[model samples]
Target: MEMEKYFRVDKLPHIWCPGCGHGSVMMSIVKGIDKMGWDPEKVTVVSGIGCSSRAPGYMNFNTLHTVHGRPIAFATGIKLANPELHVIVITGDGDGAAIGGNHLIHACRRNIGINVVLFNNQIYGMTSGQYSPMTPEGSMATTSPYGNIEPPFDLCELTRSAGANFVARGTVYHLPKLDSYIEKAFGKEGFSYVEAISQCPTYYGRRNKMKTPLEMLEWQKKNSIDIKKARDLDSEQLKGKIITGIFAERDDEEYTARYDQLIKSVQGGKE
Candidate 1:
């Protein structure tokens, strides 16, 4: 689909597991960038350590593979330094919601002009099937052989409340919706967050009895409900359903622009 030029041919065989959904999520991001006709040189993709983090290596753009759970922090710096660059952060649930969570909230709070695409695979796919903060309660993982007891974070709601200008959630099964959400995020002027629910057949699905990638994808299709329809349903009816769609969008002043204005004001006031 003309996506080959967006990728590094040398990095052609990615290291993700067979049937992993991260590839689809990464494709959605690339598709969004391509649709916008953004220059590869003006775009910067930053990622932290995890299966989803490997995407930047494949993309033919300015990329940074940062330390575990810190891509948001690095991306923030990159945006602050060069407001003209389109900074897109590719982070996994383990890398984003666990340790890097603080950065995520604050970046949303400050309304930085960066796009964060969280690949929510639910389990730490690259680290041998460990449970992540987005892992649903009662889900089994290598670290939670008895089933995870902690409730998963509602990332879309979290980011929206934290002040992100745009917040949306989509699953790999809903490819078109996922692509639309990412494209909308890229077009937003302030902090934007897209939760791309992905599947980890090798880790999450296997341990949870889903077994195959198709099974996992089917599960997503059955469990997902759009936000517009979700509002009409009661909590009981919505229970166990993944609410997908944009939860928030507002025209708030972005951090970098505010900083630039501050600099101008200070300089103008100098006597």
Candidate 2:
């Protein structure tokens, strides 16, 4: 089937730079939506300010371009108001892990049925290439001229510890795997976090010695290892390896479901 049918064609020529992997990750999301055959009107896409936040504008579905670092906050309200709708959040490393870190962690803690497609470009691509929470230690950005002293977030572990029902990681270099992860996230019952490590050649690459976008992707390909393979290796062997796969999944009760049950109990006593 033609995947373009899911997108608003007029919104073509997205604002992302050439070779930026955000486009690929967005396409994978669209393909997952196509697989689900969900009605556009029933799906709500929420985004914060960033290159990744521009995704909701290109899609034909119901969308909300919210304030920076606040997509999850808005998405929470959207889901709570209408439990039947499929709410998805699109956010960036800077927007999600940096300014929105509290919201991101709380969303997982609440186990709300919201799907979060987190685009981790490592650097702040939208606000002139600043160092983001996901920026690898030693990686150079505008804010980190010499090198970054801060250690990067292992997002999968963070979300899992925060109590998400599902957590997965995929790189733009692995499109099919990314599609599969998104599909799984869409089907999840509680807070779902899917991390997509995208490439920002224009900023991150130029600052980190990866002169071309392809070179950045090549680095991802070399550094990443499947979760299944990682189990066979020791922690020392796994160092510097980006582990990709679903990190966790659970059948815990979603927030709305539990709330509805509470309402039913109160009404039952009333009657």
lDDT by residue for model 2 (1-271), tens: 5646678878788899999999999898988888888887899999999899999999888999999999999999999999999999999999999999999999999999999999989988988799988998888999888999998889899999999999999999988999999999998899999999899999999888897999999999999999989999997797667899999989888999988889889899564
What is candidate 1's TM-score against the reference? 0.97
Q: Candidate 1, clashing residue pairs?
A: none
Runs of candidate 2 with Cα error greater than 4 angstroms are 232-236, 269-271
The candidate 1 region of ten consecutive residues with least summed lDDT is 1-10
Check candidate 2 and list the clashing pairs.
none
Which one wins on TM-score? 1
Off by over 4 Å in 1: 269-271
* Cα RMSDs, all models: 1.4, 1.4
**Residue-level lDDT tens digits of model 1 in 113-199:** 999999999988887999989998899988888988898899899999999999999999999999999999999999999999999
How many pairs of residues collide in model 1? 0
The 0-to-1 C-alpha lDDT of every candidate, in the order given, reads 0.94, 0.92
